[model samples]
Target: MPPNSQPSPPVSPDGTTDEDAVLAVRAGKGDTAAFGALYDRYVEAVYRYVYYRVHSDTDAEDLVSDVFMRALRAIPRYEPRQAFLAWLYRIARNAVIDRARRTRIQISFEDALAHPGVDQIVEPDAGLLALADKETVRAAIARLTPLQQEVIVLRFVEGYSTSEIANLVGKREGTVRGIQFRALEMLRTLIPSREALA
Candidate 1:
């Protein structure tokens, strides 16, 4: 509390400084270093999101680069209406959709299983593991609607809350929850219980 002292930056719930907005503001003003910082912070997250959807490491790497390029071009006009990561995710989601439209490539469950990141993507949950193997779970997830798959991956694989997912996907929190609920129900049917198998 000295007269010349400045207050510390705000911290997020996870204890990290919530500097993305500040960095974004700086980047908007042509600060390349600020933008680089943001890129370092979120490139992996964007890669994971894109990789899961596309199921191709080569394509995901290309898309991540494209997403950041698009974000760099578009950040000057960025508004902080939502978390910066959420805004970035919107860009990534759109990029994936655009690629899918261009290629018209259907992502098969077999391809998802063959993806190198498959084991990392579907970490075993005790309850789910009891019901089915990792391959079964991954296949069931792939079969869900795209929105459902997105919600599931963000919630479980990426450890995002429903509120965060809503912001990322531009949906109401309740809607995200409904998507998750229905996705789970569909998964249950798709992966038969051990008792049923017996």
Candidate 2:
């Protein structure tokens, strides 16, 4: 690798690269550039995960900011038993949960289905069809249970693996797999038979 090559991407959280141990160590020790690099590496995935869960650009935006803030605050004591992204995601997930709890907010799955713009949660007004598609996908994701929703966001949306999810959520790998299966089943079952079957 070139001496000036860009930093390596964090582990897949699926058990691939393990460089997060090093990057995270540096970050935890007060390395702003390392943290920035970490943010550069995972911002999109983290934002997408929060966007899918909250289903509102306004909520997701605030939540993403909170997640990063929490991560920075918690970084000083971070332990690397899991991939850094997984740890960061755990923090992000907690922020989402906290936001909902503190506000006593109840986001209805049905409402989310009816209003897909919630998934565009981060301002997806690129155009009509694109905006529509974001809503549709977000609505589909809403059919899942909250746990499944988190898993999906971490797995598919954030590209984590079952193992990484296991660490992030403090669940066993088997549980994560089961959740994935059940979430997919619920989404399929709720959709039209043609779509489900096809």
| Top model number, lDDT | 1
- TM-score, one value per model: 0.72, 0.70
**Every candidate's lDDT:** 0.72, 0.68
Q: Per-residue CA lDDT of candidate 2, range 1-198, in tens? A: 333443333456444336666777788999998888778877877788888777688988898889888888888888776568768777887887788679876656676566423322232121222323456557666656678889877777666667667767777777778898777655543333322223
Residue-level lDDT of model 1, residues 125-190, one tens digit each, is 326534576666665666677788788878877787776676677677778878988877666656
Q: How close is candidate 1 to the true structure, as a TM-score?
A: 0.72
Instruction: Give the least accurate 10-residue stretch of model 2, judged by summed lDDT.
Output: 120-129
* Candidate 1, pairs of clashing residues: none
| Global fold similarity of model 2 (TM-score) | 0.70
Q: Which residue segments of model 2 deviate by more than 4 Å?
A: 1-10, 13-17, 107-133, 189-198
Error of 1 at 131 (Å): 7.4
